[model samples]
Target: MKLKRLQKMSSFLHVVLKILSVSSVVIAIIVFFMKLFNSKNIIMNKLESDTIFYFQTEFFAIPDNQQYIQTEQWILVGVAIFTCILIAWLLWIASLIFKDLSTGFTPFSEIEINRLRKIAGLLLIYALAPQILYSVLHTILIPGYSFTFGLNMSFFFAIIFYCLTEIFRYGALLQKESDETL
Candidate 1:
């Protein structure tokens, strides 16, 4: 009964994740084109407005003589699009895992273990890539910008998923031995 419920839930979540993955890719594409065309009316103006908000929130004071650099704005938009793509990729992997769970009779299997490892690798990349990209671009585009390093929740999740994959592999091996004995 519990396995049935889990399978049903996994099926539902698989559908949801698939939809979210596609939607994120679509959003990333739209953002890319908006940035590519240099849409002054929409994306550029929005970035200008967001710069004020960022300064106000971070520094608690808005600079009166702050100049808007189009190159910096472009870099920020590129990072945003890259982040969206990464999110979509992660969601697609998650959807595949859920699809496998929904269809397979046993969760502790070789395919599922491999899928979990892939997710863990992707999560590690997702955690670090945007920060690295931003620092590199800013160091090149903006004067006197030092490299920044940070870690977020995704880093921790990557470790957890990798551990889980190992555990699942062990379980699969144990199950196989038991079945052979029987």
Candidate 2:
């Protein structure tokens, strides 16, 4: 029965991975086209809604002069997006790990949660190396500190982390049950 459950889980994971890959590609294509068509407009809008100059306008402070989002800042944003996507991808793979650990695709326990947390931390550090390096360099480019990417990516990670935690937490319980049975 356990073997059958694992097999089913493997099949499901295959399907989920395929869906994620297809969707990611489709989104990239759409984003590419949009960027090509409206690159200037997007830059113009960002400049128009430049929140940094809040006092310049009563409602919204548009940068009076054209200014580019700094290269380092751009890299930071790129890193944020990459990190968010990486977390999402890892969580997907985690589903498989949980299933493999279980007779079924069940949740893990507190101990397992801590283990996954460590893994998550490692993954975060790996993903953040580039951002950290660029931020350090950015300090050299800009004499003083500058605005960084907002916590928007954190919002997405929160949801993914919670869901994964819940799933793995259940696996933990089952794990305990199996140990007791043994």
Candidate 3:
């Protein structure tokens, strides 16, 4: 029956979400440490190679003076690694939300509503955080460079999540009213 199928699907999703949450945490930790330790060496090696071979690095242009470029690249690598870990953490939190939803947690519940709103706000931050980090980096690291700012598609997703939270609030109100009439 449909109910049985729904139960099976929910259980499946619950299991998957739990796995994803754990894996995301592990992966984020691994990536954070790996990048933290190796990024400097990696950047150094690439810069050395690029200087010797007269080639440009893909991530950024190698300006004249290897020492100054090395310092700038180090900062960039650190910021990029931090950004990667942040995104993974966000995904882990998202998995937590989906996990509860799959395990019969009501969307209209206060706890679920709060989680949804928190994610919505995080999504907005997610949209903006990297730009702010990069802008600051550019201002500090790259002299005579103009600052540029823009929002990506994640802002749209944040808006959608916010709307979903409001819809859930309305649903909860309606459910409470119906319960009162019973």
Candidate 4:
């Protein structure tokens, strides 16, 4: 593709990504507040209608003498909202990087390589965030929760980004050498 057309396409994509990121954040905030209010309503309704009780367990199966009572919701909405924001922020950063690279510079620029590195780091974080959040939520909300983990395809994208970062770094180094020799 022609450099000028490529530049235009990249700029267009950057704008689109920025718009998406902003919209995602706004939607996430809206969803969080809405869910919080909904959960509160649910909790209130439950509290008015029934008795809530939780027995203290000394082990997985044994209930101890201690007992507790409450009517509340764990409200996973916050976690979901935060995850949306996190992903949106990553998209924003990516858009910024693409915008910067969309100028009339070669792809092997040092700036491009650094941006790729940042993207790689973000991808790795994105891959890990859900697992970490799941473990935390499980421990907090579920009694006697066992350790659970599973690898998914998203991890492959993380690995792909890491490899791309290394490849970009190598390309930047070679470009620098070529420029110096010229």
RMSD, each candidate, Å? 5.8, 7.9, 7.5, 8.5
Selected candidate, larger TM-score, 2 vs 4: 4
lDDT of each: 0.75, 0.51, 0.63, 0.64
lDDT of 2: 0.51
Give the higher-TM-score candidate: 1 or 2: 1
| lDDT for each residue of candidate 3 in 1-182, tens digit (9 for 90 to 100) | 86556656766765675566566567656655665678655542212221222222223334554556655565555555555556655565666666666666655777778777887888888766755675567556765342435546777788999999999989989988988999
Error of 1 at 90 (Å): 1.3
- lDDT, candidate 4, 1-182, per-residue tens: 78878889889989999999999899888775665577445331111122132122122322541221121133245555666787798788778776975776777877777777777777777656654664566455545442334444556677898798888889989999999999
Off by over 4 Å in 4: 40-75
Model 2: residues with Cα > 4 Å off, grouped in runs: 1-14, 21-39, 44-67, 70-73, 98-115, 118-143, 147-182
Candidate number of the best TM-score: 1
Structural similarity to truth (TM-score) of each candidate: 0.79, 0.42, 0.69, 0.75
**Deviation from native of the Cα of residue 81 in model 3, angstroms:** 3.6
lDDT string, candidate 1, 109-144, tens digits: 787788788888988887778667866886676654
* Model 3 per-residue lDDT at 90: 59
Clashing residue pairs in candidate 4 (N, C-alpha, C atoms within 3 angstroms): none
In order of lDDT, best first, we have 1, 4, 3, 2
Candidate 1 vs candidate 2: the lDDT winner is: 1
Give the lowest summed-lDDT range of ten residues in model 1: 51-60
